[model samples]
Target: MALIPVDAALERVLEGINPLPAEEIPLHDGMGRVLASPLHALRTQPPFNASAMDGYAVRASDTLDERRDLSVIGEAAAGARFPGSMGQGQAVRIFTGAPVPDGADAVLIQENAESVSDRTIRAAKPVEHGRHIRQAGMDFHAGDLLLEQGRRLDPGALTLAASSGHARLLVHRRPRVAVLATGNELVNPGETTGQDSIVASNSYGIAAIAKEEGAEIIDLGIASDNDQHLSSLFAKARDTAADILVTLGGASVGKHDLVRGALAEAGMELSFWKVAMRPGKPLISGRMGAMHVLGLPGNPVSSLVCAELFLRPLVAHMQGARHEPDMRSAALGAPLRANDERQDYIRAVVRHTAEGMIATPFTRQDSSQLTAYATANCLIIRKPHAPAANTGDDCRILMLHR
Candidate 1:
């Protein structure tokens, strides 16, 4: 098959995808979850005109003149109301969040009033009507649409939902991903192996990426470069009912690479393979029943880059959340040679400079160098068959997680 472009491959992977079913959960646990439907206010906030500060609720006409004295009739605290209405020259001591007494149109702050006696207080300053009074439905009203569908519940959103009288919320379910690592020369971390064996490390990083995208992960452990092991792992992934199945390594065409063959034998329908990109060209994608399958290269850096480019968005899409990479423009900090047929995502150190953003790519971009990938903060994008460029040339970059 012909090599597919990066954007085209991503479009194919995400075509016809829809968010999962919604489930109702407590408002407290709704944080970081996507709203499945519009949230409306169940009741008006405050429910009535209330005092916004600790003061005296008095008739506006009684406090219009300076040095005015009024008799204290009653007191109103939060969750309590003064039953009697305010008569002429009568005032009520009210606390914040307390309902305003009937016949009271203004609130004279305590700081602006002086106690003349046990029953009388004098207003030292003139008071305006409706001052320091929170009107009914000031924050929100019943049946008001406070939050729209597809919004991710942040701290502010959660507080709003709670204040709007929502004890429960409808949100999209988190996607579940099953991850497996494949290689004959690989061993688990801290395990004894032969001189030629290397420790398997791709599954951990891939799992972390999946988690950051709000996916629940199930590690299927390591699968050797044989049909039996690979088939068994695939069956386990299918039995787990995972939304997406990610396989690390064994994607390229080699004598020992058996992931593609095993997946085919396990009834996987191939979508596309061999994307036209550097360090991740051997990427494969297919479908097995209802589960989506993605085959990543064995090299650590390649696997991570592919995950960021492909898997992250897929997970977000499944959960009804928006996911877009932070792509930015920058100036090349050093000269670069021309590219070949494949596109390149060069790992680089990005820094804010007086001119603008400056991106300096590492000297070596070998896919196996995990240390270099860890140290880089961005990936400078280079298109296929591009010409040589000098320092300070314009470029685009994708910012990575620090």
Candidate 2:
């Protein structure tokens, strides 16, 4: 049977997904979380008109002469305000962040003034109105919305929230992900490997991807290739209250492919069973009650690729987070053969050239190879039935930094 297109598959998967519930968390621990609602400023910044530098606060009209001498009535430090107004020829000594005196309309830096006596000072240079003065609400005003809903909190966002008098933030809860690996010949990474068994590596990679998408993982370990074992694992995943369940391997139609059967037993509705993509053709997507499930191919490279192509977006949608799809084009470093019926996602090494980005596909195109996938920083895309491509041909590329 033919495979489904990437766009169609993505649309089907995202149709029913919904954002998780909101939770209140401390501001310090809110980084990377999506805000549930708009955040309003509770108080105005610089509650009072203040001086931005250590200097003298005086009326703008008083500094019209070459050297205007003014009597110092009182001093103002940060968090301290001068109670009375200044006279026509008088000034108040002020420090950085101190509230400007009531009658003063300008501030001159101390460098522009020289002390002449105990109560008087002389202007060393010219002065302008509003110089070195921070008016009330200069940064933000009260009742103003500083951040909108669905914004991911970053360093600047956190600082803005703190400035708005928010001790804690309201954000969407992290999506819960359950991982289940299937195969009778699979063994734990730390266990001594049997001649017929391969070490279980897919779970770790999938878990890492899930965490990067802001989802919490609950690992169900490996389930032997049997209906009983698979059923037990499915039940355990449900008990953990997982919002998305990911099953590694056993997605194709084989004697040992018990994932579909088990899902049927668990009352899951199969959405799609395959995609038009190389290495991950056996990918399966389904819904089990309120939770979504993604079945990936057994090969390590294929499994990780499927997780990136499908699972990551599902998790992001559930968290109310926005991410740009991997949509980039680059020049092919070498000639490529005509693509078959399956869409190709060949592992490649992408580098910057004087002209533009250059992508070269690895020699071995097998799905099971892991080392090549590790060294590859990009995935070169080839549509199904695509014609043969030569060097410098334009192709889509997906950059993988992690």
Candidate 3:
């Protein structure tokens, strides 16, 4: 099959995808969850015209003259509103958040009012109408859509939901991702191994990336290069009802690459198996029943780049949240050679200077080098068949998590 452009490949992966079914969860547990329905305010904020600061509530006309003394009436504290009304020459002692008494149009802040006697307070400053008062529905009104559908509930959003009288929220379910690694030479971290054995590291990075995007990970561990091992892991992933089955390594057409055959046998309808990208060219996209499948290359950098480019969006879209990478313009720190047909995501160290963002691509961009990927803070996007550029040339960069 011909290599597919990166954008076309991603389009294929996300075609016809919709958010998962919604489930109601407590508002306290709503952080990072996507809203399934529009959140409307249950009641008007402030409920009534209330004092914005500790002050004396009075009729605006009564306190307009700083020389005039107003008679003090009943006090109105928060949660204990003054039931009676206030009229000309009447001032109610009100604290912050207290409901302004009826007929009172303004609050003379305590700093601007002086106590003349036990029953009288004099205005030190002219009290204007509506001054220091929070009117009803100032923040939000009942039936107002405060949060739209598919909005991610961040710290502020959760607080807003609570303030809007939402004890619970309807949110899209978190995407479930099952990760499986393949190869006879692969061993788990911290495990004893002989010659020719290499510790498997891609799954950890992949799982971390998925989790950062609010995905629940089910680690299928390492599968040796054999049909039986690969097929059994595939079954486990299906039995676990994973939303996306991510297989590491074994995505290419090499002799030991068995993941493709196993997934195809397990009823996976293959979408494509190659992308026109340098580090992550052997990427795969498919689906089995309702579960999506992605086969990533074995190289460490390749797997992570693919995860950022493809898997992150897949997980985010599944939960009705947007997780696109942060892309921005920058100046090249050094000269770069012409790019090949495949798009290149060069790991680079980015710096902030008087000249704005400066991204310097690492000299070595081997797919197996995890050290470079870890230390780099951004990826310089070098388009396919591009000509050489100098140090000061403008370039585009994708900011990494670091």
Candidate 4:
């Protein structure tokens, strides 16, 4: 079968992907969660007109004259209120955040005043009405939308919600992913490997990626190439109520590659397979009822690349995040060879240069090398049928870190 282009494959996988239903959660547990409903201000901010300076609050007209000096009628500190109203030539010593006196219209900062006595002060500058005064609901008003749906909660959001009188938030529940690694020759990393068997490592990396995208993981330990074992694992995945199922390896034509078949037997509607991407051509995606199933290639590097290119977005979108690969343009540090019919994601090291960004590919481009993938900070994307590139050639690179 001919391989599908990268964009088309991505479009297929992302079509109709949206966050699940929302749920109400306590404020303490809402950090890093996506909002499912709009957050509204329940009360006005700075509930009353307040002072913004630790000085005197006086009627603006009281200081209109050139040599206006005023007597302090009363004092108002934070958490204290001045009872009497102020008239011309009368002032209130008010601290920051204290409610402004009824007749006071402005504040003369301490730096702009000279204390004549315990109950009097001389103004060094003219005061303006509403100056240094915070009006009621200045930050937010009751019934105003404070945060929209799909907004990710950060520290600032938390503070805003708290100030807006919200003790809890309605947020999307974190999706759960069931990760299963399939193959007869794969063993657990902690177990001693035989001459012909290798440790199953792709699931660990993919699991971490899913969790980082805010999805909880249910690792369905390594399953050998057996029909019964594969069937049982799928059943367990369903029982765990996973929102997504990721199967590592056994997604290709090999006799022992039974992931696709097992999923189809379990009623999965195959979406697509064989994307036109080097090292990850055999990747497959499908859906079983409401659950998404992703078939990742057997090669460690291929599995990771597929996860970044595909799985990350699926999981992020499931939680209503605008997810996309972190791609940026860069200049080549060295000459690169031509690409085949598939788009090549060449593992590379990115560096800052006097001219601009530069990416140099690793010496070996083997699909099985996990060390190279780990060492690479970027992937130089080469389009299908693209010719060789020379030093300083412009190219698009996917940054591993933001």
lDDT of 3: 0.92
Kindly list the per-residue Cα lDDT of model 4 for residues 150-182, writing each as its tens digit.
Answer: 888889999999998999899888989999998
lDDT computed for candidate 1 = 0.93
Question: Residue-wise lDDT of candidate 2 within 1-402, one digit each (tens)?
Answer: 457887788888888777899999999998888898889999999788999999999887788885678888999989879888877888999999999998898997889888899898878776888889999999999999899988888899999999889999999999999999999899998899988889999999999998988899998999988888898888888889999999999989989888888888888888988998888988888988888989899999999988888898888888887766666789999999998888788899998889998999998979889999889988998888999999999999988862
Winner on TM-score (3 vs 4): 3
How well does candidate 4 match the true structure in TM-score terms?
A: 0.91
Assess each prediction's global lDDT (C-alpha) against the native: 0.93, 0.89, 0.92, 0.89
Off by over 4 Å in 4: 64-66
Candidate 4 global CA lDDT score: 0.89
Q: Which residues of candidate 2, in runs, are more than 4 Å off?
A: 115-120
lDDT of 4 at 16: 91
Model 2 CA lDDT for position 161? 95
Error of 4 at 402 (Å): 3.4
Alpha-carbon TM-score of each model against the true structure = 0.92, 0.91, 0.97, 0.91
RMSD over all Cα atoms, model 2: 2.4
Q: Please state every model's RMSD to the true fold in angstroms.
A: 2.2, 2.4, 1.4, 2.3
lDDT of 3 by residue, 165-231 (tens): 9999999999999999999999999999879999999999999999988899999999999888888
Q: Pick the candidate with the highest TM-score.
A: 3
Clashes of 1: 0
